[model samples]
Target: MPNFNNLQYASEPGSPTSPSEDWAQATADLIVVLDGATARTETGCSHGISWYAEHLGKSLLLAAADTTLSLVGVAKSAISRVACLHPECDLTHPGTPSAGIAMLRPDGRYFVLGDVAIVAESTDGIAVIVDERVSQTGVAERAEVDHYLIGTPEKAAALLPMKRAELAARNIPGGYWIAAADPAAADHALVGHLGLDDGAPVAVLTDGAARAEVFGLLDWAGLLDLAVAAGPLELIQRVRAAENSDPLGAKWPRNKASDDATMVTASVAS
Candidate 1:
């Protein structure tokens, strides 16, 4: 078996202070990333996505600590706990706060929900683990907004409407799902294992941080290299720098100018 190395991590909001809505935490054997969705309209849950993400992360960590619970079970426990915190709010609100989750554990098991990702580097190249079902969603407003030029005022103007549409499609048939008030969403999560004997490196990231690679700024190999050499936060900084240079999103079209970013890197062992 490959001797495991230390796990390192970094996280930052797209902007200052409002609490980024992106959450990440790592232990010697456990790593997790959570990306909270932006609300289209105000949901009854006044706690906000950032607070929801933070609470959910804590609950998930607590759930994961229970050796007897399966990953799905852990997700259920977390969801239940978070839901309980907002009994007075409409948990079923279309705009209810939710988050995508990506986590790795000592058992070589991996769990994924929504767009948060886990990329594994092997001798051959890189393999990305993502739940792409979100794309298959047929939300017309989102599709229409997606057709707009990114970084343009038109795209910016359409965001709220598009977000409203996204909510309509979430957790429903033919729509993408995430960790929301319902624990049932966890049943829809993706779970699997990695063999540590190969000593492959895995990088767990929130969508914002992974956007750099998506925008072609860095290849998977290059991203991994930078993470090891300069640290994961550098990758995010580089992305921010690139974004800064093109504040208008003219060079690269994307939904937002900046996003909450987080990354965790580790070499797993059996």
Candidate 2:
């Protein structure tokens, strides 16, 4: 059997007033992860990330509890419910809701979506299971801008027409799971495994922590490795130190430079 443990945290790096990002977990020899979409409207009264995140997290738990539907089914149902409740959410087209999810199941099956990563830890090293939508690949890219920004039924229809087609164009890397981007709601990719008989630690993290450069720093993998070797408190301090080292004049390219970062690390007992 696999033993599981998780840690959750939230931070408001950019705006002092709006703390929209949400995180949640459910353990049953498996784990589910989600990142709600940041709201597009500036004055929509809490219409952005937090609303979707809270709904997605609760919906995921409901799906896990329901026996009739598969994980994917539960997620789709949840998206529908969310859409109904928040009529303002433009889910019809290629709009990507808050992204990424990984379900670790007892049957050894794992399903993942988008950029949220699933990495297997072993004596050799750590390897990522989810690949970011953007990379070195030079393939043509399409954006469903309307889908993401739509507010009306006619606008959503017009904007979303190319959503399925756009999603079809992207190429997924090997060993990485992908969920087709949905303009109005969340996207989910399913994966399964027989259980980590290998006896290594497992990690699922949001892109903020996993991104190679955050606030102008590189070698995030190196930092994660050190954190794994050291204790959690040491890891936190190390991150703090790195963030502090940035000179004021130096510009950080990240949109959410001081983003809300979260990670869940688990290992099978000896």
Candidate 3:
């Protein structure tokens, strides 16, 4: 059996709210993390991002309940429904529109979208599966484009035309996975999966917690070693420190740049 643990924290860089992130876990088969996109519209439907994230989390939990669909199928179904609610935007579009998802399954099938990072460690060391971030759009240039994922319904309605045009111009292909090439200034979107099997443990982290800086500043490998020796909660603390420290952050910069952090650590038993 694979043993796992997860933790999440959201710091409201703008809103009065403490955190704008959400997470879900499945002991029997899967683990997921969803980050709400910044809203750009005023339709009040922009809250749709949160609703989408939370809804996806719940859908995953419930779909797994059916014990029929694989984790991928469950996620697909949830995403499909969420996409339906906001016809203005489509999940398969080219831009880094609004949502993200990462999952680890019992069969060693792990899938991810957005800029979340997943690390698997074993005797082979560590294999990092990182979601591509959208390329940087520049601090100044972004202002002209409205810097946020649609949040409220009104915003969703209002931004639909602009977003649609943007999508059309980009020639967004239908059914493409969504993601950011650079979470900070993303332009490209993504969705993909990788197989994991080796004599080791697995860890998945949001961009904030697993950036190159965290690894350089704290000896990420050493930290992972310590986490294995100590436990997930302590490892969670280490990630927390990385977020606060921004040890290697100079390499990666963002506009609305506060990252919601989440990390899941697991061991594949012999």
Candidate 4:
């Protein structure tokens, strides 16, 4: 029964006009982070990506209150709970609201679905768990989108077809599993237990903040160190600075110029 000393941070990259699509929530014994998948095309749900993420995050936290439930079971329960909230929405639509998920529970249990991640520091070294299936599924389409600069009309056109292809492959065998309309996708998450020394550091990150590592700003260890030292918000500030330096994707060549970033930094209580 490990308790946590945790700090959560989130920021949307572009305008402050709209709410962030990313969400992070935590209790004394649980931490969850979700990166709402940006819908490039029409999604059947009118509640939008942010609404779905908020509801799903709350549902997951509620489901996780039952310590007996496995992480997969919690995910499934949460997904089903959220689904029932909006029966009128066309959940079967390929472009319906979805998200990448990362969670940490007491007893050093961690789970990751889609591209979100859980990172922990152990005596062995830095350990990270994340599902890269989504990245692997949209290769050719992603390559096409990567050819053009971010935010350009050409890039938008390329992104449309890529998003369509990705939606088609999502939650299907040989494609990727995410927190979406299907509860079965929960079974595909990467779930495991790590042996963490008492007071060991852990972090859950959405791809937006994790992309700092992808963009070569810091490795996992360094990211953890930064969060431990300056705090999680500083890590996001660094990511924002990096993104500001390369506003056009001339260097990083990512799908968006900047994304909604969220991170939760915590430590096992001795």
lDDT of 4 at 1: 65
Candidate RMSDs in Å, in order, are: 2.3, 8.2, 8.0, 1.2
Q: lDDT scores for all predictions?
A: 0.81, 0.49, 0.50, 0.86
Ranking by TM-score: 4, 1, 2, 3
Residue 250's lDDT in candidate 1: 67
Q: Model 2 residue 179 lDDT?
A: 29
Candidate 2 local lDDT, 1-270, one digit each (tens): 545544322222223566736364747455666654443323233355666676766766776677576667666666566556666644433343444566655334565665666665544455456645433222222232222322345444533333343343333333222322232222325444534554455656566555433333445465455445553334444444554454231333222324455555555443
TM per model? Answer: 0.91, 0.63, 0.62, 0.97
Error of 4 at 66 (Å): 1.3
Model 3 residue 191 CA deviation in Å: 7.8
* 1-270: candidate 1 lDDT, tens digit per residue: 233466778888887756798898887667878999877588878789989999999999999888788888989999999999889889878888999998877556778999998877754457677888775664566666666666567787788877766777899877788999999998888898765444567788988888878889998778877886678889999988988887766677667678899998877665
lDDT of 4 by residue, 1-270 (tens): 678875555555444676788888887788899989988898899899999999999999999989789999999999999999998999998888998888887578888998898888876789988788888877899999999997799998999889988988998889999999889999989998987888888888888888879998899999888877778888888888998899989899988877888888888885
Q: Model 4: number of clashes?
A: 0
Worst 10 residues of 2 by lDDT: 136-145
Clashing pairs in 4: none
- Global lDDT for candidate 4? 0.86
For every model shown, the clashing-pair count is 0, 18, 36, 0
